[model samples]
Target: MKFALAQINTTTEVADNLEKVRTYTRDAAEAGARFVVFPEATMSAFGSGLRTIAEEHMESWRSALSELAVETGITVVVGEFATTADKVINLLAVYSPSGERSDYAKIHLYDAFGFKESDTVEAGEEPVLFTVDGEDIGLALCYDIRFPKLFAELSRRGARLTVVAASWGAGPRKAEQWEILARARALDSNMFIAALGQADPEVTGVAVPKKGPTGVGHSLVSDPLGKVLNSLDGAERLEIVELDLSAADTAAETVPVLTNAKLGY
Candidate 1:
């Protein structure tokens, strides 16, 4: 199956962000992509003052995404900030071509690198694993990529592809860290890894003027053997790559990492 990684700039306005998503989804679908994954916080700005969409707005967003999926005949994995009773939840919503929807909350909050994501966002308790076109896919958020155990658990659950939506901040060695973590996770789990990140010059708000680049947008895909199939750097673009599920099976047979490691769980 071919997957498209959409590296886009997001802002506080839901409508504006959805428009960008629509454009990319159409483009990706036209390019023969079976699935398209967007970066994290695509519905809102990724910062200390993140905004959550109201219940009504959330429903509207879901409806729009469902329509997009049905029209394009492709699956879409999109990120958004959902409002809860106590706080906002970082969520990834998966929309199938048949208009089915599933949501996955972020399990690992970004409380590192001088940012306290846990202060406002609630962590999810379960990992999300779903199937599309006979392929098992796992969903993870930004900080979740840094944890190998999560990827291993997904592999154990029969996930051939793991998708990570990230709003990775830019700093010293942060880009390198993203690439290393992505490759390591794919290699260790013997699965394909699709890591999509938000681009820089972040759209702060509806009213605020856009600034220069800030976020790191190195969206990439790695095979089971840790080989990067395709990657995008320093721009908002669509990257499409065909993934072979049989390669993952072959990698597992050769390395036998999952079977070799004995775990208490």
Candidate 2:
């Protein structure tokens, strides 16, 4: 299957961001992508403030996303800010070609970014594994990458490719952490990893420090062997790569690494 990961910059303008998503969805469809993924909070970049997020609800955002899914005839996974009865949460909306929807909330929040995401958002404890074109896939957010057990559970539940939708800041240390950790997760779990992040001049006006590098925009696709299949650097990108879940079976049959790594549950 052809998969496209969208790394676009989003701000407070929900209409503008939705338009951009539509354009990218059309582009991906024209390019023959069967599935398309968007970055976290693609609708509107609610800054590190709680009031900003609480004010934005999922009702308005879901309508546009559902419309886009029906129009494109492509499986679109979009991340946005959602509010429940209790608090706001980072959410991923997985829409099927027929307009069916499934959601996964951000399980782990990024509290280190001078933002109290957990305080404003209720954390999700369950992991989600959904199907696309007969392939089982996993869903995760940015900070969730730091947790291996979550990915392992999805893998055990038959997820061959885990899509990480994130708004990673630009910074050398953070970028390095993301890169190494992503590849490691792919290698250890023996599954393909599609990680997409946002670009510089973040929607938030905080002005990410030049020294920090918020996100160098090197969105990548890695195989089970920890090999980089394709990548993009600088600016927003829509990368389409062929995801062959059968390949994972073949690799595991030959190496059988996962077979030996017992979890002792």
Candidate 3:
């Protein structure tokens, strides 16, 4: 199956972000992709007023996702936020053409690199996965990629491919760390890892709020064997790559990391 990885700069405006999603979904659908993955902060970028949009625009966000799925006949996974009384939940919203919709809240909040995501975002308790045509797809967010246990748990629960949505912070070796972490997680879980990141704002000349982990665009996909199939530089782009989903099974059969594990989640 073919998958499209969407890399674009997220903004503080939700409407503009949704329009970007629609445009990318159309492009992916026309290119014969069954699944299209958008990076984190698809609803709005990480800046001030995040909670406001999460509170007011959540219903419309869901509506757009559902409508996109039904219209394009493809499963859509995009990042969004849902408001809580005290904070917001960083969410990965999933929509299938069959009218099935589900979400995975971000389990691991970004509390590192001098950023305190937990101050505004609540962490998810459960690891989530959904199926498309009998092929299981796992869900994860930015900091979640750092925890190998989550990936193993998703694979334990039957996932051949994992989607990691991120709006990575820009700093020393951060981009390299993102790439290494993606490849390492692919190896750890023995599954295909699609690491989608937001486009670098600097590339687009968009002034982002300071101290925000806006983006450092280098979205990529790693096969079960941890080989990079395709990757993007720091730019806004929509790249598609086909995957032999069955390769996950072969990698598992050859390495057997999940089966031969001495640990458990």
Off by over 4 Å in 1: 48-56, 202-214, 263-265
Error of 1 at 81 (Å): 1.8
Residue-by-residue lDDT tens digits, candidate 2, 1-265: 7978887777666777788899999899889998899888776665644345436645666777787888888888988776677688778889887878898988888787665667767898899977888889999998899888787777778888999988786554777777777887787777888888765454333343343214446678888888888777757778888877777676667766667777551
- Return whichever of 1 and 2 wins on TM-score: 1
Q: Looking at candidate 1, what is the lDDT of residue 55? A: 47
Highest lDDT: give the candidate number. Answer: 3
**Model 2 alpha-carbon miss at residue 224, Å:** 0.1
Candidate 1 C-alpha lDDT tens digits along 173-207: 99999999999999999999999988755332233
Q: Write the per-residue lDDT of candidate 3 for residues 1-265, one digit (tens) a residue.
A: 7879998887888888899999999999999998899988889888888898788899988988898899999999999999888999999989999878999999998989888999988899999998877888899999898999999999989998999999999999999999999998888888999999988888877666665889999999999888999899999999998989889999999998888888454
Between candidates 1 and 3, the one scoring higher on lDDT is: 3
The top-ranked prediction according to TM-score is: 3
The CA-based lDDT of model 3 is what? 0.90
Ten contiguous residues with the weakest lDDT in model 1: 204-213
lDDT for position 51 in model 2: 43
lDDT of 3 at 36: 91
Tell me the deviation in Å of residue 59 in model 2: 1.6
lDDT (0 to 1) per candidate: 0.84, 0.77, 0.90
